[model samples]
Target: MIFEGYHPLDKTMFQVMDEEGNIIKPEYMPDISKEQMMEMYQLMIQTREADLKALMYQRQGRMLTYAPNIGQEAAQVGSAFPLKKEDWMVPAFRELGAWLTRGAKLEMIYLYWYGNEFGSYMPEDLKILPVSVPIASHLNHAAGIAWASKLQGKDEVTITYFGDGATSQGDFHEAMNWAGVYQVPVVFLCQNNQFAISVPRGIQTSSETIAQKALAYGMPGILVDGNDIFAMYAAVKEAFDRARRGEGPTLIEAFTYRIGAHTTSDDPKRYRSDEEVEKWKKKDPIDRMKKYLMSQGILTEEENEKIIEKAGKIAEEAFKYVEASGDTVLEDIFKYHYKEMTPQLTEQLAEYKAYLMERGEA
Candidate 1:
């Protein structure tokens, strides 16, 4: 197995390809079909286009604060590729590529960031949790889901995504501990994007590698090149297999970098130098994947340009659709929180509507 050779304590990432798209470890290259490879690349492109569009919308005061997943697409998309429709995905706020790969609608993503609660609603078939803004809190939710699935004798695995900073939280430890103890079929994916807002990974924890933390909880762990799609795919595919085999949780620390600000409200330049940014740009996940595809004759330069342009159009169309869906009904504000609106909420909704009617704005 792939995990047998790569230990977390090695301090070296398990990689199949280099930054220049050369397959250095051809043995570890995944068995993905060309069609799926192209789909992953397209998803990455769509993710970036959507992120850039969101940034523009936020700047123009048209959208609410959004977390961009520019540089971390490979980590998100590759890890999510192994998930079955019956499987569960619990996410932190910055996994746009993962959501897209796992069949989340682009318009839903846009609407969520547009401050609509309806955006959080996934189709019944897609077992995904809502976008959690709290750091590490959702780890517990993911663990609990896996625990329940196991208890009910269902063959389901749950995958949860969070940043490197989340490892410091008690929830992370608790979830990891519980999963390990119960041998729940869950994967803890830590997109170690080098920084947690202004704090760098070095200062976030004293451990040599985030993946190694899995050992403390009695699970297998491995570090993978987060920017290398093949590496990420191989690692997660194996992790899912182990989970399906009832071997319990595995921690995968995808060593990546966040190219944009932590969110629309923050500035990355304030804490990081342009030189460092440029250095990471050379390791762009989408670029490397495109190069690999081109080498395999699955894509050409001309076709890639067209694909990128089309992805932008898709993002634009999705956002336009979200906007065209019109504003939220004011009653939905007080109506959605409970199975039945309580008497107090009923009274407040009436009072609020009456006030709005008196002001001629209802």
Candidate 2:
């Protein structure tokens, strides 16, 4: 595992599977049951379908906003699947696959996108935090949580997910510095999807790789081919294992691509070319996994069709649930904004209700 040359980051892009669906290192494959592998594949399909359906909902003005993870399935699923139920997962905006894999309800995800804050609520047993829309702000929170867990002697690791753009944030550096100092049991997984909206990775930082930034924080950093699910799983699993063993945090840079716009509001076509998108499409994480499964005779054409059909049905059902949930109640915002409302806020709420009543819209 030695990286060589002037910039070791340039030579550390680890890949388990080649572009043509061939396994470059059979030994590096993730250690999971065949059934688990199949489930992961199905989840990847479901994630893509859900993203597409959400885009449709946005187009129809049924959803407020969405950050799609269309092409980064392997990076999300691979890292999430290895976590124990007791481990904590803190996600940035575009971690639908990780959230879903960690027991988030599809309906709740849709509801959140449709402007209802309740969708952010997770079950008491699930250790997933609400999605943070701000870039890398949650990194510090994750570090704090991990530090607290360490102090309490909790046998759990905290993993935080963010995009390549997040690496440029001051919060990222601060979190990494604190985590290193305290030896917090946290794993920072950065999904480097090449671009942060219109700004490309090159312009974001002078560093050769986001993973290399970890060295300054006194933590091990590994760069993996994010499109290769096997590599991602191996990298993350090892990182978390090390964390749970009282090792300090590890920074993993999943070098992948974003094949879609930053969000429904963004038009990536304005900055990136179709050719670049197509190039990444050929190296699609999901497609490569499916091809591998087929090569092993574990996935047949009939089975693939059934998986796609099931995913579509799930997406449709989630969409319907959100639609039926209706619009967000305007007054609920005031109630949830604070534990106790100030007199001024209470007066404003009363005035708003009165206005609605006068208009017969309440």
- Measured by TM-score, the strongest candidate is 1
Model 1 clash count equals: 0
Badly placed stretches (over 4 Å) of model 2 are 1-10, 339-344, 358-360
- lDDT agreement with native, every candidate: 0.93, 0.88
TM-score of predicted structure 2: 0.96
Judged by whole-model lDDT over C-alpha atoms, candidate 1 comes out at 0.93
Clash totals in order:
0, 0
- TM-score list, all predictions: 0.97, 0.96
Cα error, residue 76 of model 2, in Å, equals 0.4
Report the Cα lDDT for candidate 2.
Answer: 0.88
Tens-place lDDT per residue, model 1, 167-186, is: 99999999999999999999
In model 2, pairs of residues that clash are none
Across 2-57, the per-residue lDDT of candidate 2 in tens digits comes to 12211335646878888777988877766788898898898899899999989988
